[model samples]
Target: MKFAATVRAAALCTAVALLPATTAGYAQVEARVSPEFARLFATYQRIKTSYVDQVDDEALIRGAIDGMLASLDPHSSYLDGTALQRLNTMIDGNYQGLGISVQMEDGAVKVISPFRGSPAEQAGVAAGDYITHIDGRLIYGLEIDQAVEQMRGPAGSAIELTIFRPGRDNSFDVTVTRGVIELEPVTSELIDGNIGHIMVNEFSADVGSDVRNALRDLQGQATGRLTGLVLDLRRNPGGSLDEAVALSDLFLSDGQIVSQRGRNRQDTIVYESETVYRGDVAEGLPIIVLIDEGSASASEIVAGALQDHHRALVMGERSFGKGSVQTLLPLTRDSALKLTTARYYTPSGRSVQEGGIEPDIRVPQLSDPDAERRQRLAMRESDLRGHLVNEAGVQDEALERDRLDDPRFQLTAAQLEEQGVTDFQLDYAVRTLRRTAGTVASR
Candidate 1:
């Protein structure tokens, strides 16, 4: 769930070859295929002829292409058939399935997150849970796409998943009914003390407009006056880059929002405030952005912009650092290439490639019993096999450490429930905002 772009009409061809030869003035340059290509063809011929069993030409070629892209980076890959369809569905914001984001980790299907209000979440599927069986069939060695395919079926259909939670002693089974997942990109509520809590689930189309409308609705619902705001972005794997810029523009009046640079100079682009929207929509309300390890791509973009501009106080853990931009280049009618094209920088010129947008105040989700263990096993951009390195050379060890065992956060999940606090992060943020509601100063 990252940003994607359509292919441009024109491409710049500025590559030039230089050669040094016996003649000092000018040397002729020859253009030919590299010897590695010959080796690849040789391997393909060997696989076709000398293999014990007959091999399909298409499969071999596809494997070669996949291998080539895999060597470059994790994000660059071939998208065809179901993969292409899934990408389109996510951007369009609706599908029929048990909505959960998963990945292949060590040949096991690991759950990244269950979308809020989705069937999987309602069925008790949590992050860090591993799906070992589907419909009573073992699926340990299946590909992630294959597992996802099995989990998705017609709406109202029931699917049984065997989940192995890390902290639990034994695996458990849960039957989840697949339903039409109409993803609400933005959701809002007027909490106690007249604080507006806006949860941005994803950066899909019209997210900025939805958030703007949500703010209006919350303002209308407040009894006295709108005290403060909480922009909840936790577990929001990102989408549309344009939407991220638009969302940031709602709070920033001037200055650069984000900038991206690629190999070609033409690909270098800068997004500034007032280009998407006019001015600050909050009207100087104290705001807090909640992020976690699941907040990625577009989420980081908005967080970085707001934090850099001093427009909001960012709380929660460091984000899932993914600063590169992926552009979807169509190869055929039903196929495309999701290739990493550029690295984006924050308004302060900080590249959150490996080191994500660090919160101004680190806050842990004390309501979840397994939050401590999950944080230790969480994966970030730096954990990927072939991730792009930040040119600024950030060291993860230098970043602020987690406060999982903080003395101030001694209340257990059971204790928090007894106190009627479901989400400690949002509760803490709301209280913090109430202390400085009308006195908040913005740059």
Candidate 2:
């Protein structure tokens, strides 16, 4: 039907205008109708005429579009009118809902971890719990976003979830009423040895301010400056791009912070650190970034920029490879397409596409053996496959050989699979930073 072609054409223009410009360089000049989209379009047209029941053309178009977008990025998926608004509100980090974080891993919607003091956490949701059904419907093969949508309801409304936790054989159910999630992204802790820990759960619009405020509060409470900063990016499935850039620039002075490139347009868009500087004086202090498989998108942006610039040392396994930038292109009735615009690179021009930013010292999580890749071969056809963004062109080089073995360190990348205990790794980072501080003091 011409209507299908008409919808695609009109939606394409609307999508382009609503999309984000990735990382300053190249704006998306056009949206390609992915092969999957094209094939689905044809199928929808056929379904209209051959269906046993009278099929609505608009319904067919929306269904085809939804399925097509869902195939690209697991995060980028279909949200009908009300659903789209709800998704946007959650991303804004001020949603009214049963607060919980879940991920699509290995074909199940598993709980990553609950936000501290959140409704879900209060209701007894724990990590490693699998959500088998929402309400009464089985959500086994649905996309991650679909399952998430099932969990969302009006603020006071209650929803029941049947969960399968690792230690429990029988599926247990929890019915929790929704509430508002208005907490700021930056939260802190006084962890072992006067360590100032800042957990940046997500990079929202207010994150930069929240971080600056958190650091101030922590510094004031301590007798002297805190020993070190553990910038936890673990399970922080990224948020805003601007927040990532702002957070990276919060520590770096004059380094080329991060760059964006796609379609071979090199000089098209580059983002140097804005006028921000580490005027706080504790900027270069011993900083350890904790990353894991869930740290992705803008999360990878901050980690990659900080690690490559040597502004902060990364101390976990490779981050989740989700560096490509996607912007929301709105369409009729709150429907929009989250299209991939460009891939982000570090200041050194290294792209964190398929293979994410590897930690300076690999500290795979000791808590989960199945999570660690003992001989983890890195990459697949769809995943970005390399570690370096501008390996051939960068001026500074990281020369330290991989320390797969070290007596003092118990959780190097290779050992995480064999044993569990990231304590040694954390201890080494602290000791190294403390030693560095002493050296600086002596000088």
Candidate 3:
């Protein structure tokens, strides 16, 4: 079966959300009617009865629900109809469209990242690009789901996107042909000196098993025994939390992978290794994890776990800092609430809220001409309006570290291109692995 089908099958058998359903009955809790609630009801009544323009009850109700969640955090939202379907589409890991993870930023559709090897990426859709129009239609005030639905269509269909890139002088148009985006969560190749390079594009269904199989396949393709490994999570907007734990368990024999703490006691839970996978699949291999500003949620979980355990040397820029656990609370068969329930922490008890996973080795991608400019303009969790403050009292200055210039990474995109270096960070990682392998062999 396809991975998407596998996810649906798993969803049917287990709780739809990452956490189990609460057993406590509502009758057991004390009920209190506050004055604020009375005010809300009064306002609702006024809106229903005396509004200048007639607004449907459904729209008004949904708006009230959305407003309540909007005040809490950026991740929490009321999912129904197209929104719920989009969420399911992400979990399914395949869709016929220009592959991109997008979010509404101030009523504009902002590209989080173009999926690696997808038509959007090939067509030059970039992270932080504002999608202003789809096929000449203004998407300024449209819901994110509505805009995304307009973008997605049958395979082989062409769509024109008007993009407003931050660094560019003027808005541009890009026509891209939609294709079947089969999300291969894990892809690996045997690099020079028998170093296995695995790029995890997303955390989808059976990703842990897929990664394990990829490692085995890479090992088989190697001329000699694999000396090292590079796990790339760059530009990966995370998915299923179950798969995150499972993937981390594949590399860690024992110890806490991640912990979630919430207002409720039931939400406080810890996940450990050696539960999903028996032992480290790549035992004794020097591993490096690559992360960047786009790597979030589940990606942060895996990176933070391995880094805290000293199992892998994390490299690249700081992560997207989305540490909150979003629970899918189904209100009905056709609707659900994507609510932010808990905050996740690394093994060392580091909260990944505003403060993301800091890499052990900081490596910058110098190959992209707009890398520096984009880094400065990139929107992170902390930058989002109404974002939850870090419990550990992280300062705004810490999150603004990306704005500082690094002396080590002075190479321009033109210089790198002249030297035939497409991906500077990956190239540096590969070379580092080779050097480590040589040193190990000498011993």
Best by TM-score: 1
Winning candidate number (lDDT):
1
Q: What's the best-to-worst order under TM-score?
A: 1, 3, 2
- Poorly placed runs, candidate 3 (over 4 Å): 1-32, 438-443
What's the TM-score of each model vs. the native? 0.90, 0.72, 0.90
Candidate 1, which segments miss by more than 4 Å at Cα? 1-32, 166-171, 441-443
Model 1 scores worst on lDDT over the 10 consecutive residues at 12-21
What TM-score does structure 2 among the candidates reach?
Answer: 0.72
Candidate with better TM-score, 2 vs 3: 3
**lDDT value, residue 70 of candidate 2:** 52
Cα-based lDDT for every prediction: 0.83, 0.63, 0.83
What range of 10 consecutive residues in model 2 has the weakest lDDT sum?
Answer: 1-10
Candidate with the larger lDDT of 2 and 3: 3
| Candidate 3 structure quality by residue, lDDT tens digits, 23-91 | 122112212434555565667668768999887756766787788887888888887887788677777
lDDT of 2 by residue, 49-116 (tens): 67889877566656656666655655455556666776667766687777776766556787755665
RMSD of 2: 8.9
Tens-digit lDDT track for model 1 on 233-265?
A: 998878889999999999999999999999889
